[model samples]
Target: MKHLFGNRVIRLLLGNDLLDNIAIWIRNIAVLFLVMDKTGDDPVAVSLITVAEYAPIFLFSMIGGTLADRWEPRRTMMAGGLLSAASVAAIALAVRYGAWETVFLATAVSAIVSQFSQPSSFVIIKRHLKEEQIAAATGLGQSMAAIFLIAGPVIGTAVYARLGIEASLLLVAALFLASTLLVFWLPRVPRETDAERSGGLWSDMREGVRFVLRDARLKTLLLLFALLGIGTGLIQPLDIFIVTDRLALDKEQVQWFYLVSGVGLLGGGVLAAVTAGKTRPNGHWLVAGGLGFLAVSIVVEAWSVWVPVTLVSRFLVGIAMAFMQTALSAMMIRMIDEAYVGRINGTLAPIMTGTLLAGSALAGPLLKATSLLAVFALAAGIVAVAAFCALRLKDRPSAVEAADRA
Candidate 1:
């Protein structure tokens, strides 16, 4: 673990991801409270902000991933970080001006920039790390993500409460700038080899899509992925409302829920890393199990308005989510050829975001027509269906590490 950070490039990139993720989370918290303050936390307004965050992944990830394949990862990432900083700065200015809509606009644009940034990071890690080192690097990344996801909301909301929205957003901008600076020293990685090249961007994209669809198991896995997206998307936008409106927790205390679940996420990452060499359970089952756990959590949260039960269930949800996603990623690393890794994952972004969009769209109507408990039960039912599909999944252990279990 210590040696992993000893490598200069890995250290820098990991720090970049850490700072970038924290910046994004802080921005999201700021956006959530900003809209709430401006619009009285209107459901439609909140949904729109969340949607804006996801829309670019649907629209631009393929183009960005294709470019990532063709360009230098470090430079592309640097450009992305600069754009992110500018976007945050623009939003900070927007906050000062009371231009509520521009906040959403800025969020969407930043998301578009992120489409480029994320793929480049993926390729950088895949290319730079040795095969054996990949899992450890991934574990490290997830661990940091868990930690930052926990801290971001707590720190971000505190900043907003203490310093005001404008100052908090400026803080996000500073983090983005810091992230960009960290990448300045990363060595230039080479472009794809002749054998790695696809004919053109469109052709490469089509090929990536084709590659993903050709495998029945991959198709099945994506179906489960879509289900997970839909089920959770329905839950996420309403969380603040559920806290303040439903559970009646103060806005400042929302961090408590995040704290509990984030601790679970960190613990899960640690547990998975400890077990990775010993137990590479079938990836599909892990995902299915995770979804099932989320379903159970939703139901538990809905069972009573009592906060402690909901908190514990949410913690379990975090643990389940970490284990599931880590398994799914390891499967991808093991099964996919290196050349198409960027594009294939890129194309899947739409599948994820699109279903989430559908789920978000459904949330408002569900709330209007039914109670929160009903909505959660519906989410549970949807996730159970995903789990059934996962149970039907036929993906075998193909990666050397995972295959050892088989």
Candidate 2:
């Protein structure tokens, strides 16, 4: 008997996804370090860079999703890849020329362009797959993505150390181009000729927003995720900063923290995959995972000792993150109509995107006013609220049907 695990599309996506995630992680870590290095530990500058990277999802994500609806996913991916390639190349050149201002500007622009690619990705994947496959696909995608989290910084730092930051940026640029080629395997999408005629892009976006708000459960899920985002986002940059500054780790050593967290992510993915079929009610998973995540963050913040304690805490948090992500994504799939997966996915993007921005922007001020440890504690408190909200979500009949069918 062929193992269900041996699906070809899953394998293909997983392989390319690992490389793709590696590129993204490299770009992100490099930009964070580069910006910090150049700007001399300015938290606002760091926050701005994070904002630049994610803010586009809130601003242009609808446009990107609408474009995805109109065009072929492959073509959209190609365009996005090319645009990302150009942006990264420009950043590389800016660094080479000692144009720090240009470096920050180019990085921001690059992030904006990269967001254009995301909606198409969600649409394309939905168009091709069945509902049951989505979770596994998400699982594998996340697993490989976690692998990148494990390796990207270490590798990026190595390249940055030996070959300079420009070289790493150029490598990232090359990876984007490669992602373009990989996406070419995706089927062609018929363009939305009626995009203008069909109530304009703004109207389409409004409809998506209205649909989610109108759905009782979906609105709840969206808000829950928003709170989740705010919770995690607050801790993310600060966590890295603390590891680097408080723990006194060099660049390469800092990667170990992520590596430990990545291991937890991978372990959680494996658990999700193994137990996906066995589990019937995913809601409990979500609740438990969220609480687990919050607990880990609190413990880490309070007892943050040497590297070992931090690593252990972060690893447990990573596992919780993995479980939470799996459950949340599954819940998202259950809430939407399969036909409008793209639109539904698009609708959720803003909440996730905006929440991150709110967290990053807000966290900067909070960090300035209080201790970083205090900030982590507050974030944990927010997550506890979210988890409480999630517990109130009564599992619907439809969710059960979706699970049974899967």
Candidate 3:
């Protein structure tokens, strides 16, 4: 544990993830608030903002994953970092020009850049670390990002209050630049071998998909993750509307709800870091996390139906979310073969993108048709399905170290 925490490469990687995460937190909250303020529309409009943001991940994530396999991981990551920085800068410039709609467009462009960044980052870790260290590294990386996720909203809120959302955008852009710099210091990682390569781009993607489908473990993991995404997607939009309408809360107060959840996220990360060295009870944790998330959804979205309860629900959901994400990513890193690791991961991106879109799209119709409680109940049921999917995974001993790449 000491060695894991103290490694220089670990420090570098964690630092980069942390800054990028802070930027993400700021960017997410800022965009939603900015849209609501400018448009004065309902929660549906805010959700649409997210849809635009994630649409590219659906389109290009597999391509990004294939590229990660074909190229040096460090170089891929560096390029991603640079693209993210440039996109962030573009948003800042748009804000400076008072081009609000253009800012949304730039935000979407930034998301597309992230489609390139994340798959590369995941593959880099998969290529570099030992299998034993992979969980610890993944946990620690997520933990660092969680820390930023925990803190960034509060900081962004303060920045938003003092200097407006544009100022927050500028700060986020700066963080991306810092992340790019950290990428510069990261160790180089090799590309996948000829055996891993497919005939052409489309063919390569097809091969990756075929590989994932053939692997029962990979298929199960993707199913669980997709279900999890769908369950949460239902709840996320409700949280905003609950705060805005049901609770009749102001923007500042809503930011506090985000802050509370961030704290829970941090706590979950601590737990993951502490448990990293132990044999993972992967199926158990998945079920527990999913159930916990379901419980939170019920409490906030269904039963209590109040602001404080919603905030607490967000926190509890964050806790469950942290465990699920850390465990699942580590599990995937262990289960997949080196050759198809990038592609296998890439395959999940579209699933996530689809689920996110579903969540955003459903928020509107559901809110219009029924009560918020019904929407929340729907989330809980979806999450239960995710947990059930996890039960189907075949538990296996952790694999060989994830260190060497082709």
Candidate 4:
């Protein structure tokens, strides 16, 4: 593990990743609270921020992927990072002048650039990391994500509550600046597709789609990822409402929840790192079981069991998500050609975000019609089916070979 970070490029990219997530987490917490304070906790109004965050992925992910494939990862990452910092700074200034809508606008603009940043991260991984190292990197990435997830919200909210939103935004902007520097420091590796890669953006996107469709394994994985998206989306809309309205948790209690879930995610990430190589044959099971337990946890929360159970469930869900995401990411890196990594990732962004958007919209309506328990049960049931169907998927010893042969 120590040797992994010994690689200069890996260390820089990883640092950039941590800083990037820190900024995102802070921004997310700030915007959520901002909308909440402004609109009296209106779900629809606050939800717009989320919608804005994801809408850009739907609109620009493919283009970003194409660009990543064509451009140097370091250059693309640096560009995106600087642009993100500038945007956040702009938002901070706007907020100071009493422009609340700038939060959503900034979020949307940042998200649009994020389409480029995300693919570039994967591009760095694929180009730099060896086959044996990929799984470990995935686990490490998940751990950083978990740490940021835990710290970002707590710090962001605490800073906002004490110092105010402007402070939170400034903090996020500082992180972004740090991340941009980290990106700039990363050594540039030329892309594999620079010479032969040509054609319009739409044509390149079509090739990406055709490439995935040509492979049964990629096709199946993509479908499962979509289901993962829907399952994730189902619970998201209920989070704030449940915490604020149902549990009536004060700000402090929310921190405790974050602590428990962060610990869970950290645990899961460590476990995944330890088991990455060993879990290749049964990666889908990890995802399936993760999804299944996630649904169960959601149902349990809806069952009106808040305290230790809800806290425990949140932790377990973190574990599940980390396990699933780490396993799948490792598997994807192992199976797919490095050249297609960006496009494949970009291709799935929309499916995930779209379903999440839909779920957020639908869950509210469902809550109006049914109890939270019912809504949770629906998500659980759907994911349970996905898990069961996953059982039918053959555990190919060589997913890449299987895809190639197909």
What is the C-alpha local distance difference test score of each model?
0.75, 0.68, 0.72, 0.77
lDDT (10s digit) by residue, model 4, range 311-405: 77878877877877787777766766766777878887787678766777788889889877777788878667767656644444345545655
Ranking by lDDT: 4, 1, 3, 2
Clashes of 4: 0
For candidate 1, give the lDDT.
0.75
Residue 225's C-alpha lDDT in candidate 2? 78
Residue 183 local lDDT, model 1: 88
Off by over 4 Å in 4: 29-45, 91-100, 158-171, 192-195, 239-258, 292-307, 368-370, 391-406
Clashing pairs in 4: none
Error of 2 at 124 (Å): 2.6
- For candidate 2, the per-residue lDDT at 112 reads 66
- Per-candidate TM equals 0.79, 0.79, 0.80, 0.84
Model 2, residue 58: C-alpha shift (Å): 2.3
Per-residue C-alpha lDDT of model 2 across residues 1-406, encoded as one tens digit per residue: 0243465544545555655676776777777778788889899988787667666666776677666666667777788778888888987887787786655665566666656565666665565665555556666666666776677777777766776678778888888788777777666655556634567767766776776776667777787779878888887777666676667776667667767889989877665555543444555555555665655665575457587777777888887777677666755664564434556666777787678767977888898899787888888887777777776554443453355447
Give per-residue CA lDDT, model 3, range 194-214, as digits (tens): 676547777878988887777
Question: How well does model 2 score by local distance difference test?
Answer: 0.68
Q: Model 2 residue 284 lDDT?
A: 52
lDDT of 1 by residue, 1-406 (tens): 6666787878998889888887777778888898898899789999898678777887898988777777788899889888878887887787677676778876887888878877787777777765545556666677788998777777778777887778777888899899989988888878866577648778888877887787666677678678878988888766766678667789887778878879888877766655542444454565677678778877887675778777888788787767666655655655555566678678777787788878988998998899787888888898899887877654443343243344
Whichever of 3 and 4 has more TM-score, that candidate is 4
Can you tell me which runs of candidate 1 are displaced by over 4 Å? 25-48, 87-105, 131-136, 157-171, 193-198, 237-255, 304-307, 367-375, 391-406
**Alpha-carbon deviation at 364 in model 3, angstroms:** 4.1
